[model samples]
Target chain A: MNGLSLTDLTWAVPLPVVIPLAAAGLALVLWRNARAQGVISVVALSLVLVTSVALLVAADDGPLVLDIGSWAAPVGIDLVADRLSTLMLTVSSAVTLCVLLYSLAQGLADNNAETPVAIFHPTYLVLTAGVANAFLTGDLFNLFVGFEMLLVASYVLITLGGTGERIRAGTIYIVVSLLSSMLFLLAVALVYAATGTVNMAQLAVRLQQIDPDVAFALQLLLLLAFGIKAAVFPLFAWLPDSYPTAPAPVTAVFAGLLTKVGVYAIIRTQTLLFPDGRADDLLMWVALATMLVGILGAVAQNDVKRMISFTLVSHIGYMVFGIALSTEAGLSAAIFYVAHHITVQTTLFLVVGLMERRGGSTSLDALGGLARIAPLLAVMFFLPAMNLAGIPPLSGFLGKAGLIQAGAEVGTPLAYTLVAGGIVTSLLTLYAIVKAWNKAFWQPAPEEPREVALPRGMVGSAAALVVAGVALTVVAGPLYDYTERAAATLRDREQYVTAVLPGGRGEGRSADVTDEARREGGTDRVEEGSDLEDVGPRGGEQPAPPEEETGSDEGTDEGGTP
Target chain B: MIDTSPSLALVVVAAALTAVGVYLLLERSLTRVLLGVIFLSNAVNVVLLVSGGRAGGAPIVDYTDEDSMSDPLPQALILTAIVITLGMTAFLLAMAYRSWQLNQHDEVQDDLEDRRVAQRAARDEAAYLSDDDGTTTLEQEAAEVHDETGDDGPPSSGPGTPPSSAPGSHAVPTPEGGDAR
Candidate 1:
C-alpha cells in the first residue's frame, strides 16, 4: 500500500466527493430558506475547489489511489487521484463554482418563472458531486453511478420550472442521456464478461490478454457507450436539441461538462486500456465527421442557444483529434483542449443566456442592436466568441495550436487531414459566432419584441468565467506543461500497473499468478490484481520515454499472440 | 436465466419495440412521438442486455464456484439505464405538455417553414396592394424609388405609441414613419 495511510492526508482524497454530497443534503434540508441554501452551496463549492487544488498538488508527482474502508482492491471501491483525474476535478470544480454563483444570482433576481430557487442550490450541489465522482472513480461501475447521479439532477434542473421551451429541450436531453446510459451499461456487461472485471485498471490488463476478436468487440462497445455520452459524431444529435432549451446556467454546465465527461471517458479508455492507434482510427474519422456536421448544424441555426450547441459539438472534434493521434503531444494537447473548451464553452453559454435576458428571445431574427444597448453584455459575448473561434492570445488558440503541432509532428496524411478539418471547423465556428453577433447585437433592434433587460448580477457571473478564460490564455505555458506531464504518465502502463498490483514489476509476471489462477478462474485472478494496483502512485520513471513505450505497447499488443 | 434461447426472443422483442417506436416517432402527435422514444430506448436497453448473454444465471459471485456467476455488470448497468430513462421520459412528457400549451398544438412543425409561408403570403399581399393604387401612397412610392434618400415620410399614430418627446427618441426611429401624418 506504499506505506502511506489514507488518514495521512486528513481524508483529503474523499473530501471532494463527500463535501459536495453533504452540502447537497444540507441544502435540501434548508430548501425552504433560499438564502441559507445559497450560502450552503457557495461554502460547499469553495471547499471542493480548495480540496481539488490540494489533490492536484498532492498528485502532481504521480497518481494516488484510495481503497475505500482500507479494503483490498477489486473487493472495495477505489477513488483514484491521478494527474488527469485531478486536473479534471479542478477544472470542473472551478467551472461549477462559477455556475452555482451564476444560478444563485439568477434565482435571487426573481426574473425567472415561479420555480423554487431552493431546489436549484441542492440539485446543483448534487450535480457537482456527480461530476467530481465521475472524474475520480477508478471502478467502471462507479463511473456509471456517477453519471446517473448527475443525469437525474440535470433532468430536474433542465425542467426546473416546467416551462414550455425548457421542457421541450429537457425531454430530448433526458431521452438521449438515458439511451447513452443504457449503452454504457451494455458495454460494461460485455467488458465484465470478456475480462471478468469492471475496475478500469484491472480491465486494462485483463483486456490485453483476452482473445483479440473479443477484445476488439469489447473496445467497440465501450467506445460506443462513452461516445454517445460524449456526443461524438454519429451519437451527437441529441445534444443540440436538448442543450438549447435549458436555462442559462444549466445549459452552460451541460455544455461545459456533460459531453466532456464522455470525452474524458474516451480519453481514459483509449489511453489506459486500448492504446492501439489502429483500433481508434475509426474515432479519427468520426472526429472529422463530427466537426463538419456540427459546424454545418451551427451555421443552419438561427437561435443563439442552438448555434452554440452545434459549436460545442464542433469543438469536441478537436479533443477527439488530439486523442486519436495516440502520441504524447497529441494526448497532452487533447487534455489542454478539454480544459480550454470547458471554460470557453461555459462562458459562451452564459453570455448567450445574458443575451436571451437582454434581447427578449435567443432567436437571431428577434434580437438586434444589443451592442448599442448594452456594451458590457457585448464584451461578455465578444471575448468568449473570439476565444471559441481560436483567436490569438486566447486559450482556444493555444489548445488548437497544440493539436495542430502534434498533428504536424505525426506527419501522416490522415493527421494532416485532421489538422485541416480542425482549421475549417474553427473558421466555421467564428462564422457562427459572428452571425450571432450581427443578429443579436450589431443589427438594429426589432419592432414589437419583448422588452428584455439584462438581469442584475448575471453579468458578474459571466464576467467571472471570462476572466478565467483570459487567465487560461495567459497561463497557457504552465498549463500545457502540466497536461504534457499528465499525458506522459497516462501513456506509461508500467507505472500504473505497478502502483495497483502488489509485487507488480516492469515485466509481465504471469508465473507468480499461476497459483492464484488455480484457485480462481484466470479472469478473476487478473481482475483482483488489477483492482489492487489501479490507483497506486507511480514510482521512479522519466516522463518523456513513456510516449515511445505507449506506441510500442499498442503495436505489440495488437500484433502479438494472446 | 430463462431456460429458453432468449437471444431469439430478445431479437423479436427488440424488433417489435423498434417498429412501434419508429411508427410513433413518425406520427405528428407529440405524445405518440414521446412514447415512441421511450419504446425505442427500452428496445435498445434490451439489445444491450441481450448482447451480454441471456443464460438465467445470477451475476452475483459465490466464492466457492468461480464459473457459475452470471454477468452482473450488465444488470448493474441496466439499473442505471432504467433510472436515466425514467428521468428522460418524465422530462419529455413535461416538454410535450409545455409545447402543447405554447403553440396549442402537439405536432412538431418547423417554425421556419411557417415563417416562410407567412412571409410569401405577406409579399404577395403587398404586391396585390401595390397593384391597387388606392391603398398605395405617393410617399411610399417615392421612398421605394429613392431608398438611399434617408426619407421615410411622417410616422403613423399607433395604439400604445411611445410619446414623441421621450428621451430615447433620437436613438431609434419608428418603422411606420413613412405612413404616419
Candidate 2:
C-alpha cells in the first residue's frame, strides 16, 4: 500500500512479540542489575510501540501475514497483523509502556520495597510479549500459548510479595485461571478434532463445511473459555477478589490488558471462524448481565481498588455487547471502547495508587479532604474517573455514543434493552465514581492531615496516562475512522483468510506434500478454483475442506492416527 | 474420513479424571485445589491426544511412512501444554507453601467483601445505610471479617460511635477469628 511492500511491513509483525521475548531473556539474565533490567524493558517496549504503530498504519491497507519460520498457514503457526490486531497492539503497547514507566517510578520512589525489582522487569516483559503474541497470532494453538504466557506472568505479578492477603487472592486467581486454561485447551482440542486443523485462516474456510451442531458445540466451548477469562457475567467471581490485592502497577496493567485479550480472542473467533452469529442473543444477555451486575457491585464497594475491579468486570459487558451485535458498527465501537477503557482504567488505578500513597488507605471512609491537601492528585483522579463514567465530550462518551447509535440501528427489542442497560450502567458508574470522589476528596478530613510527599515519578506517569485518555477524545474522529476500517476488514473475513493462505495455500515448502496428497488421493480439487488445500496424506495433519473435496476420504482413511 | 472419534477407553479415563479433578477443585485446601488443577489439565491433555485421531508410529521423517505416522501437531500441543501445566504446578505449590507459612494452613479463604455482605445480610442491615450514617465503624466492619486464624469479638457495635480519630495512622484492620470453614 505504501511505497514499501507489505512484505517489508510483514517483518514488523513478529517484532512486537519477538522483541519483548528476547528482551525478557536478556532482562532475566541481567536480573541482578535492576537498572539494566528496567532499561531493557523500557527500550524493548518502546520498540514494540514503534513496530505496532507501523503495523497499524500499514495494516489499514490490508492484513499483514507472517508464517512463523516460513512454514505456511494450516501447517505451521502464523502471526497476522491486520487492522484489528495492530490497533489493539498499538494501544496495548502504549498502555504497557506508560504503566512500566509508572511502576519504575514507584520502584524508585519506594526504594524497591514494593516490587521485587529483579523479578518484576523480566515478568513484565514476558507479559507484554504474551499480550503481543495473543494479538498477533493467527493460529488457535498459538493463541492458547499466548494466553498461557500472559496468564503465567500475571500469576507471578499478582502474588509478588506472597503476603497473606496476596497469597489468598492469588490462590483463587490462579485456580480460576487454571480452570479457564483447561477449558480453553479442551476447546482447542475439540476444534481441532472437528475441523482437522488449528490454523484460524484455514479453519475459517473449512469450518463452514462441518455439521452445524458440532460447529455450534465448538463455538460454545470457545465462548465459555473466553467468557471466564473476560470476566463475563456469572464467571466473574474471581476477578474482584483477586485484582485488588496486587500492587498498584500490577493491578493497573492487569486491569488494562488481560481481559481485553480474552475479548480479543472472542472477537477473532466469532467474526472469522464463525460468522453466522449463532451466539448473538446469548452473548447479548451475557453483556447486559455483566454490565448491570458489575456496576451494582461497584456501587456497593467500600474500598477504592475493589470498586474499580468490579467496574472493570462491569465494563467488559460493553465490549461483549458490541460483539453480540455482529455488525461492523458494533465491532468498531467495541474496538474504540477497548482502546479508551485501557487508557482510562489504567490511569484511574495509577491515580488511586497515588491516593493510597497520600491518604494511607484505599478505603473511602479512611480517605478524606484530598482536594485540600493534594489538588494535583485530585485533578489527576477526577479526569480519568469521569472519563471512565462516560461523561459527555470525553472518549468514553464517544465510544458509548457509537455503541448506542449502533444499537438503535439494529432496533431489536433485546438490542433496545441493552441500550437502556448501557445507559443505566453509565449513570450508575457516574454515581459510584462521584460517591468515591466526595468521600476521598471533598469530605472533611477525619483528623489533622500529615504531609506525605507524593512521588514525582508516580504522579508524572499517571498524568501522562490521563493526558493520553484526553488525547483519545481529541483524536476521536480519526480513531473512529480507523476502527471503522478495522471493523470492515474483520467483517469481510476474506481479507484475512487470503492474506494468510495466498494462492490457496501458505507459502511454505509443504506444497510438495500437498501435491503428493493430491496425486495419491486421485482428487482433481486443484481444478475447483483452487479453493481447497488438500490435507496432506501425512496423517491428515492439515484441514481438507469438507463436503466438496473428495480427496479428503483417501487422505483421512490412510492418514488417521494420533 | 479421519477416524476423529476417540477410543472408548480414552474417553472414560478423561471423564473420570475430570470428575475427580472437579471434586478436588471444590475442596478448601490449596493442595487439593492444585491436585484438581493437575488432574483437570491432564484430562484436557488426554482429550488433546484423542483429538489427534488414533495411535500410530513416531512421526519423524525416516521412522514411519507419511501416511502411517501420527498427527504430530496434537502431540506437539500436548507437549507444550504439559510443560505449561508443570510450570503452573510449581507456582501453585510455592503459593500453597507460602499460604501454609503465613496462616499455618492452606485453605482458600472466602473473600472479605463476601463476608461483609453476608454479615450485613444476616443482620438484615442495609450496606447503604451503614455507609451513609457512618454507624458501622471501619473497625466493626473489619472485625466482622474473620478470613485468617485467631478469635476476637467486635470492639464496639451499633450507632453514633465516633469514627476512629487516627484513621490514617491505623494499621490495616487485622480482624482474625476461628476458621469460618
Candidate 3:
C-alpha cells in the first residue's frame, strides 16, 4: 500500500471543492469586512481554478481516485477525477472564479448598506464548492451531500436582498429543489436497498445482475430526479417563474452553472451507471419537446432576463439531445455544448446585469438605445447572444453542428425529429435574443434612461467571459479533442471502474466474455462487459438483514454534519 | 425483508403525511404550502429511517457479531437531509411571512407571465409564432381574436369566466395591460 505511486495525484482531486468550502468558512468568520471576504474569495477561487486544471491534466494521464481517510471504495467516501469529472470541474471552477469577481465588483460598486453583501461572499463560495464537489464525488451519498450544499447556498444567494419578489421566487426555487432532492434521496435509498452499495461503479457491476424490469424502474426513478433538476420539458415551470427576480450576479451564476450541474449528473449517471441505453429513446423525445417548448417560452417573454432564462432551458435540450444519442460523437458534442453553454449563458446574464444598471430595468418594455450608449455592453451581449443562437464561427454553432452530425449518423426518425427541433430551437433562441436586442439595444429608449455608473469590475468580469466564449471558438479544435477524450472515456466505462476500483469487483469489464460463460449461471445476472468471476449474477445482492453486519458499516457510521 | 411493526408504521405514516402535504402544496395559500413542505420533509425523514431496514441493536458491535445493528448510513443521510430541509423550510416560512407582511394575505401568487406564455402557445398560434420582435401589439391582437373565437384551449375571456375559458386574462386578472402589469 505504501509503495503505490499510481495514486499520487489523488490528494489533489478534491482541492477545488475543498478550498472554496474553507474559504466560505473563513469568509463567514470575517463577515463584517467585505474587502477581506473579496480578497479571500478571489485568491481561493483562483487557486481552485489552478487545481482543477492540474486535476484535469492528471486525469488525462489516468483516472485518479482518492478514498477519503484512506478507506477504499464501497466503504469510504471516494472522490474520483476521471476525464469527465475533471473536465467539468475545470470548466465550472474557472467559470465560478470569473463570476465571483463580477459579484465582488458589483458589491463594492453599490456600497449598499441594506443588502447582506458579506453573506453573499460566503454563500457564493459555498455554492462554488457545491458545484465542484458534485463534479468530483465518486458515490451517490456524497453526490447528494454536494448537491445539498450547493443548493442551500443558492437558496441564500437567490433571496439575498430579501425583497418580496426575490423571496417569492426563492420559495418556489427551494420547494422545487427540495422536491428533486427528496426524489434523489429516494433513488439513493432504493439503490442501496437493491444493491447494498451506493458506489457508482459497484452499482454498475451489481445492477446488470438485477432483473431488467427492476433495473429499468430504478433508472427511470433516477432520471425523474435529475430531469426535474435539469429543467426538461414539462418539469421546467419552476425556472421561468423564479430566475428573473434575483440580483444580476446571483441570476448570472444560477443561470450559467446550476442547471448544468443537473445535466452533468444526468450525463454521468446515464453513461456510467445505466449504460445499456434504456432511457435513450425517452430522452430523445423529451429533448425535442424541451427544445421547442423552452424556446417558445423565451420568444413569448417581454423581459430580457425571462427570455434568456427560457432560452437557457431551450438550450439544455441540445445537451440532452447529444447525450441521448449515446454515441462517442454525440456525448462529446454534449460535453462541449455543456461547457460552451455555461460560459455563453453566464456571459449573457452578466451583460443583462449591465443593461439593468444602464436602463434601470430588464423588461424590454422599459429598455432601449443601449447600442448607441453602451456599444461595448451591446458587443458583450451580441457576441454571446449570437453564439447562443448558434451563428456561424461561434462555439454554440460548432457544438450544435457536432450534435447534428451525430444525429444524422443515427438517421432514425426520432433522431431526425430531434435534428429538426435543434435547428428550430437554435433559430428561436436567436429570435428571442434578437427580440430582446431590438427592444433593449436597437430601438429608442421608451423613457429617459437612468444615468448609472457601470462598474468596471462587473463589465470587466462579464467581458472576460465573453472573451472566453470567443476563445472557446478559437480553441474549438483542442477543446473538441478534450471533450472527445472525455466522451470516449464515458463510453468505455470499464476503464473508469478499473481505475477507481482496481482490486474491487467490476474490473476488466471491456474484455470479451464467452456466451457459454454468461449462460453458465442460467440466472439473469450475467453482465457481458465485466470479468465473469468478479460479480456473479447474484454476487452482491443486499443481505435484507442489514443489521448485524459490520462489513458495510460506512453507511452506518454517520458523523460530522456542519 | 418481511414486515416489521415500526418500519410498517413509519411507511404508513410517511405515505399519509406525503399525501396530505401534496394536497396542501397544491393549494393557493403560501402559508399552507409551507406547512405542506414541513409535513412532506418529515415524512421523507421517516422513509429515510425505514429505508435502513427494520430497527436493530446499536451499530457498534464486538468482533463476534454486529450483523443485527441498524444501518448508520441512512440515519446519517436522514440527519443531513433533515437539517437541510429544516433550514430550507425556515427560509420558505420567512418568505411566506414576508409575502404576508407585504400583502394582506399569504396566498401564493401564480407567475402571470408563464401563464400568459402557456395560454398564448395553446390558443393564439399567430401571437406565439409571429414573435421574434416580441411585439406586444401583435400578441394583444391575437389574444383578442382568440377571445372572440373562444378557442378550444383557453380564451382571454372576462374575470368571471372559468380558468380554461380565460387563462390568458386570468393571469393578471386585472384591467392592467397583459402580464406586464
Candidate 4:
C-alpha cells in the first residue's frame, strides 16, 4: 500500500523485538533511578506500539520476510511480518504499553516496594521483547526462544519480593512452563529431523513430503506444548492457582498477553504446516471441554481474582473453537476474538485491582457496597464485564456471533454441538461475571468500605484500557474486514511460501551455495527427470540411490517439492 | 546424501533419562523437581544431538567434504537449549533456597486457595447428607480438608503467619509494603 520497497519494510520487522531488548539493558544500567527506568520502559514500549502499527499497515499488501544477517531461508533464521503476526503484534504491544503505564504508576505510587524498579523494569521489557519475537519469528526454534525469554522473565515477575505465597505460586508456574519448553524443544528437534529445516515457510514446503504420521505426531506434540502455555482445559489448573497471587498489573498482563501467545502459535502452525485439518475434530472436543469446564470452575469461585482467572481459561476455548473449524470465517473470527479477549481480560483484571483496593479484600464475603462508595470503579468494572460476557453491541458479542455463524455454515453435527456449547459458555460467563458484580458492587458491606485513594495514574491507565476495549466494538467493522483478509492470506499457504522463498530460493547471498553444490555434484549422478536436468550436466552411467538424492536435489531445484 | 540414521545407544539413553526425570518430577521436594528439570532438559538436548544426521566429520566446510559433514544446525539449537536450561537451573535453585528459608521446607506446597475451594465443596456435600447416610459430617469433612494455612478469616499483620486470605493479600498491607492498591 505504501510507496516503500519490501527491503525498506523488512528492516523494521525486527525493531519491535530489538528496541525493548536494548531498552531493557539501558533500564538495568539506570536501575537506581526508578524514574529513569520507568521513562525508558514507557518510551520503548511506545516505540514498539508504533512500529507494530506500521507493520500492520504495510503487511496488508503482502508478507514481509527479513532473513537475519542475510543467511538465506532454510539456513539462517528469519523474522516475518505478515498480516496475522503484525495484527497480533499490534494488539499485544498496545496492551503491553497500557500495562506498562499502569505498572509504572503502581511502582511510583508504591515507591517501588511490591515491584522493585531495579529488576521489574528490565524483566518487563524483556517480556515485551519476547512477546514481539514470538509474534514475528518465522523460525520454530526462534519461537521457542521467544517463549523462554518471556517465561524466564515471568518467573522473576511472579516471585517478586520473594514472598512465601508468591514463591509457592512461582514454583508451579515455572516447573510447568519448563516442562512445556522441554516438550517444545523435543518437538523442534523432531521437526528438524523429519524435515531437515526449521524455517517455517520451508517447512510448509517440505512437510508435505514427510510421512503423514510423523507430521501428525509433530502436530500433537506442538499442541500439547502450547496447550499448557495457553491453559486449555485439564492443563489449565495451574493458571487460577498461580495468577491471583501476583500484584495486580503483573497478573493483568499475564492474563491478557501470555496465553494468547500460545493461541497465536496454534493458529500459525495449524494453518501453515498442517492444513489438512487432521486435528480439527480433536481440537473441537478440546475446545468444548475447555469452555464448559472453565466456566464451571469460574462459577464455583468465591474470590473475584480467581473467578476472573477461570473465565480467562474458559474464553480460550472460543479461540480454539474458531481454529478447529479450519474455515476462513472460523479463522477470521478466531483472530478477532483473540484481539477482543486480550483487551477485555486485561481491563477486567485492572478493574478488579481497583475493586480490591476499595473493598479492602478480594473475597466476595468481605466486599460490599462498592457501587455506592466508588461509582467510577463500578462503571469501570461494568463495561468490560459486560463486554467479556458478549453483551450486544460489544466486541465480545460480535466475535462470538462470527464464530457461531461460521459454525452454522459448516453445519456438521459436531459443529452444531460446538455452536450450542459456545452459546452455553457465553451464558455461563455472564452468570459468573454478574455474580461477582453483584457481590462486589451491590451487596451490603460487612464492614465499612475502605477510603483508600486510587492513584490517578493507575486509574487513568486502566480506564484507557477499558476505553480501548469499547473502541474495539466501535471499529468492529473495519477490524473484522482486516481479519477476514488476514485469514484469507493464512488459508492460501502459497503466498507465505513464495514470499519467504522467492523463485525456488531465498533472496539471500548464500542461497546460491546450494545451487552451485548441486550443479557440481551432478556429473556423476543419473538424472531422475529433474527440471534442473537442462541446468546441469546429466549422466546415466552411474545410477545411485534415488531416494535421498531426490530429496536434496528437488529441494534445491524446485522450492516446492512437486 | 549423508547417513541420517541415529545411533540406537543415544535413543535408549534419552528414553531412560526421560523416565527417571519424570519420576523425580513427581516428587514433592523442590530440589528433586529441580533435578528432574535438569535431567529432562538434558534428555531433550541429547535427542537434539541425535536428530542431526549420524556423526560425520566436523562440519567445518573446508575441513570436510560436504557429503561427509555433520549437520551443524541441531548442534546450534542444542547449545541454545543448554544455556537456557542452565539459567533456569540457577533461578530454580535460588527459589528453592528462598522457599526453604521461609517455610523450613523445599517441598512445593498445595495451593491453599485450592484447598479452601475443596473444603467449601465438601461442606456443601455434607449439607446434602441425610441423618442415616454414611457420608461424613461437616466437622469431619472440615478436618479432612484442613491445612496448615489458617482458615479463620482475613490475614492479620504479623511475621510467621500464613496469609490465610491470600487473594488480594496485598490490599491489607499497604502501609508496610507501599502497595499501590
- My TM-score estimates for the predictions, one after another, are 0.77, 0.89, 0.84, 0.88
Q: Candidate 2's C-alpha lDDT?
A: 0.82
lDDT of 2 by residue, A334-443 (tens): 99999999999999988998888888777777778999999999999999999999999899999999999999999999999999999999999999999899988988
Q: Name the 10 consecutive residues with the lowest summed lDDT in model 2 chain A.
A: A531-540
Q: Which of the numbered candidates is closest to the native, going by highest TM-score?
A: 2
Q: Candidate 4 on B78-176: residue-level lDDT in tens? A: 999999999999999999987776666787877766766676686564212223223234324334543354353333222111222342333333232
lDDT of 4: 0.82
Alpha-carbon shift of residue A101 in model 4 (angstroms): 0.9
lDDT of 1 by residue, A1-562 (tens): 2334442442577788899899999988876677888899899999999989888887886676666775434555678788898999999899999988888878777533424576677888888888888998888878988988888788888766554344545556665676566567656655654555677877777767655666677678778888888888899977877776567888899999988988998888888888765565788899999999999878766567778888999889999999999999999999999999999999999888777767766766667788888899999889989999999889899999999999999988988999999999999899888888877787777653465565667778789999999999988999999999999989997666554544442122222442343345445565544542321111001113434444344334323422
lDDT of candidate 4 at residue A536, scale 0 to 100 = 13
Select the stronger candidate by DockQ from 1 and 4.
4
Q: Can you list each candidate's DockQ? A: 0.08, 0.25, 0.13, 0.26
**Residue-level lDDT tens digits of model 4 in A1-562:** 2334553477789999999999999999897788898899999999999999989998998888877886655567888899999999999999999988988787777654555668888999999999999999999999999999999999988987667678888999999999999999999988877766788987786667656767788899999999999999879989998898888888999999999999999999999999999999999999999999999999888778989999999999999999999999999999999999999999999999888877777767667889999999999999999999999999999999999999999999999999999999999999989888877798777677667898898899999999999999999999999999999999999999877754443343334653553354343222211322221111111113443454354334323312
Q: Would you list the C-alpha lDDT of every candidate in the order shown?
A: 0.71, 0.82, 0.76, 0.82
Model 3 off-target regions past 4 Å? A1-7, A502-562, B1-9, B115-181
Interface RMSD of 1: 17.5
What's candidate 3's DockQ score?
0.13
- Whichever of 1 and 4 has more lDDT, that candidate is 4
lDDT, candidate 1, B62-156, per-residue tens? 64244544445556666766776777677567567655554455555322212322443555532112121242242243223311212432112
- Model 3: per-residue lDDT, tens digit, A118-158? 67888898999999889899898889889988999999887
